[model samples]
Target: MDSRFVGIADLVETPSVAVVVDVMRACTVAAWAFAQGAERIVLAESLDEALALKARHPDWAALKDGPLAPGFDMVNSPGLLRSIDLAGRTVVQKTTAGTVGALAVKGASLVLCAGFVVAEATARLLRTHECDSVTFVVTGEDGQADEDLACAQYIARRATGAGTDASEFLGRAAASRAATELATGVRQGVHPDDVALCLELDRFPFAMVATSEGPQMVLRPCAATSPTDAASI
Candidate 1:
């Protein structure tokens, strides 16, 4: 089996499995949410859709662009989820890069969200499912984000039976211009701790797979213990 790394702009054909990476925050947040017992994560491509979903399911947490809304449980920050109990809850999330990149790879046989937290689990799932080919899509900021690219390469290495030292990748990400800016300044709603969370490799034991339920795309645990429990999560 072989895996290829590509940027969002170069995603022309979907492979057997498409692992989407947005390590700056989005995918990392999703991974932590699942680990903290989030029932399911529904991805919305736009703020309008996310708000509409939240309106229909008021109990569900909604995360959109910009600051955390007054009524929403939290924004797209892993640090915020640390103290929150997402147990048996469904969360609706909208992000600038991750979810959008996920929706773009609609042709994939399997769509899985990837970050440091779920990297090992993702590789295990890929091997267990025997995917002949895989595509790692780095959902960079506007173009190519170093963090996303590093995460993609790490996953690629792991999936191919090559051992991964996440520290190297994390070092690259931390030194990136995007990370440097975030660390040096106090971005109003952005938290530096969230960046730290994104770099924590293999923190969770499960991988998040995107599945279509009716017209919506939802993320659920892809482990053998609850393979068919998409509705439950």
Candidate 2:
């Protein structure tokens, strides 16, 4: 699928590769988890749900979630995630935006997860697979424009591998715009580190997928397991 703009509602009918973008947090965390050697990750839409999952499997997973400002065990800081030991461990994470977006794309034909951190890799996956269509679902802020749109702009370019025109500039433009938004008062607390984190390209080789186990949504290694093997993660 060539890169194109899309909405959260449109995700239901899109018969193509679905790349869920939650740049500020969720997707960023997924990339970090993979690099940290997390065997898999689970993205729950709400902190309460994520906590319950952790309670049920206390011996097997590490949990993280909470409001963004004070931060949580599963804080959205990309810097902190790098120091944690995740190899062979399962992570149950909850966030305000990204995980919710993953929940919405649960039934996509090919639900591939993405964010700024893996833009290059995401593009590679698209070029190699060349699916029927490509939809960049921006889980907007409270259903309004937020950092996800900027992240989506970058992913859209990567998914199509389009170099001419502004395809190459969308990501940079998005980040610049996000910076502008932060400065102009439309958005606040937009971290420079986070904006930079979202712009990093293809730092890892894997894309994440949201796995469903009953009512829970978890981010898992897309290449490592099938949906039927949800219990194993």
Candidate 3:
């Protein structure tokens, strides 16, 4: 199998599987959501759009990050995510990086979200796919972030059956600007605990897979136990 990393803007390859890496928070929040039993996640481009969807489905959880827009359930945060119950509920998420990149992917048969927390599990799921190429879409603000690049590399290596050191990748991610913001509280209102939460590795045994449902991109948890839902695209 061939594996390589590409930024969101450079999504030119029609890979068998595409893994979107937003390790700083977005994908991490998604992994956490699935781990907490969220029924599914909806990716929206803007706060207004997310709010509109929420208005239509009040019971669905609404969340947005990057300045923390109003008229939503909470900021895209894992600490707060842990406090809220998401079981059997559809979650709508708007982010500058993660969700946008996820929705932008048109060449991938199977789309997935990843962070350090679930990087390995995501890789295992990728291994289950019967294909020859995989792309890791680094969905950073500028289409590239140190944390996201490191994560993509780590996941690619793991999925390709190559020995990799997780700490090296985790350390590179923790040193990213986004991680620094969380630690220094530069990103006010977002908890510092989020830094630790997102950095912690291998938290789940399932993969968060996204599929297009009409105009909406729905993300659901897929167990990495075999060639299950994620392997089918």
- Maximum-lDDT candidate: 3
Residues 1-233, model 1: lDDT tens digits: 68787778888766668989888778988987887788888999788888888889998988764587765668777877777888988999898889988887866778989888888888877777777888888887654788888888887788777866778998998887657765765443467687788888888877888978888888887772344444233
- If both were scored by lDDT, which would come out higher, candidate 2 or candidate 3? 3
Residues 115-223, candidate 2: write the lDDT tens digits: 7666666666666666556777776554345456666666666556666343344455355544465445455333446555655665665656655667666566543
TM-score of each: 0.91, 0.74, 0.92
Better of 1 and 3 by TM-score: 3
Pick by TM-score: which candidate is best?
3
Error of 3 at 18 (Å): 0.8
Clash pairs, candidate 1, are 39-233, 40-233
Instruction: After superposing candidate 1 on the true structure, give the runs of residues whose Cα lies further than 4 Å from its correct spot.
Output: 186-188, 224-233
- Give model 2's TM-score versus the native structure: 0.74
Worst 10 residues of 1 by lDDT: 224-233
TM accuracy, model 3: 0.92
Indicate whether candidate 1 or candidate 2 has the larger lDDT.
Answer: 1
**Clash numbers, per candidate:** 2, 6, 0
lDDT of 3 by residue, 11-34 (tens): 765666888889878998887787
In model 1, the Cα lDDT at residue 86 comes to 84
